[model samples]
Target: MKINIVNPDLNELGYVIAIANIKDKHDTSAPSDYHWKILKCRMIIFSNSSILACPDKNDVKQVHIIFNKAGDDYDKLISLFVKFSLIQNGGIRSATPEIYQKCFHYTMTARIAPVWNTLQDNYLINNRDFLVTRGPQEAVKYCIVVNDTFTVIEVNAVKINLMLTEEEFLPGEWIRVLPSLNKAIVEDSYKDFSQGSKFKSYKNLRRHWKNIHGYRLPENESAYYSIQFWRGEPLLYPKQCVLRNFPIVIPTSQPLEKLIISRFVTCLTSKMANVLGTKLIFKLEDIQPEDSKSLAPKDCLLETQAVSLCTPTQYSRSQK
Candidate 1:
């Protein structure tokens, strides 16, 4: 990666331009897939009384904060706190690109899972151009991270929601997780213990349970288990993501696969940024995979800088 300083007149602007090549060292292919990526330097635009600060940028073209080098951007932020570290740390040395790529990959995978699962599970798939992939990897990253918990629950609705509605069952009815009765008394025993009565219909029962009780589990069994209501949607293995089957070649062979991968990476990156105590602002750019030929052009690429302040100023907020 080479660092380019464009607009020297703005050199005092406190931003540095760092460029690096991302390569697939794991692949023994002759050229070893590679791509040139860029990062904009940053200055502390805002800081709180204590430890963390929200960094901002003057350039809005980039999507993610580029560490230029690689290796746990999450961890990299930590070293920034060392005695004297303000964006320009040791002049941007070279390191592993694996972490950046993985971070992006995981993030994208996590985000797309919910939507994909929704389509597959509910059999409600559509391509009305209603996709939620119109932002930088970093921004998309946060969207997925913040929204992942909700998406997961949506994907696995059955295990989450209560099968019966207050109206479907008598007002004072109750059903337990166990097929057989527990020593626990149902103060509201008016309800039938039969699974059939627990839900008015399998589909509605599953949806209701998901919406109402997605986060809390029934208080009966101690052992871990996955309760399947119906096989309507194929189950996604834990830790398995939509990008698992995506192609390594640029300009991915599969459209859906590429989309899933890109979304996951962008989302996960934002998640990591939040943990690092930074507010990530992202801009989305479109570059076809076939057109990507630097090193290993990532499924999703991010050009990130930091934001020091998130508070909406009178001028900015009023414009809205």
Candidate 2:
């Protein structure tokens, strides 16, 4: 959404004064829920002036403002920086000396990947031990690694705040074996094959199943369900697993990929819709920091003049 303010009144120094409303979209019926959570607000000023007068004079042209949204109010009138002097043939520039910090603030709704099921349970066990012992040790570091092009990056272990509902996995889907499954049977039967080995790879194992167990392996390995058993724990045979109320966690850290960020934004927008009990309709705008010295300043008079139109009437009368 774009808002334009035209022909704003200038102050005594002949600078435009404007107020911008910093708000998120919401439904009138459910005032409690907000569609878009404004993590940060960036004010970009485009003018002919080379040097602008801003709230902070140290850096003149643009400013990044942070807002507090804990309150119930939605309408926030923020005074932005616009005062400045025009430098002939000057272009737009960022007044701040430091680079704008790239940060994000939004909520998301994502399915707990089947792999995360065991991880979450393990985390709870470790967390509970730490709490009981009151140890100074850091919590176990768990991350999700994704292959980006050729590079592999790990995502930090996320904590789930709310579980909206339980979603059942349909039959004939690939699922990871729970750690609590029988380890002895798995190790004794499939000692030759490594963890996560395909059922078709070991032809002898397949023959044993066909002869002893009286079951034949699926002709197409790709179509058959696959499972990732716990480390050092092999599955005796393929078994179907289903998920229930898989926890959804908040993404607290920035991801390496832009596509991941976009997904999070979409998920969060949908979650907000569900919370508000309203139709899901929203947009996300990435708040990227601007570079300094990008644009030149425009032409404007200096405020150094001693005589002004609004000088005190008493002083003027006494001097006369």
Which stretches of model 1 miss by more than 4 angstroms?
1-95, 116-275, 288-320
Q: Which ten residues in a row have the lowest lDDT in candidate 2?
A: 100-109
What's the lDDT for candidate 2? Answer: 0.23
Which regions in candidate 2 have their CA more than 4 angstroms from the true location? 1-259, 276-320
lDDT of each: 0.23, 0.23
In model 2, state the lDDT of residue 306. 16
- List the candidates' TM-scores in order: 0.19, 0.18
Using TM-score as the measure, which candidate wins? 1
lDDT of 2 at 274: 28
Per-residue lDDT tens digits of candidate 1, residues 214-266? 21123222111122222221111111111111111112224543454454445
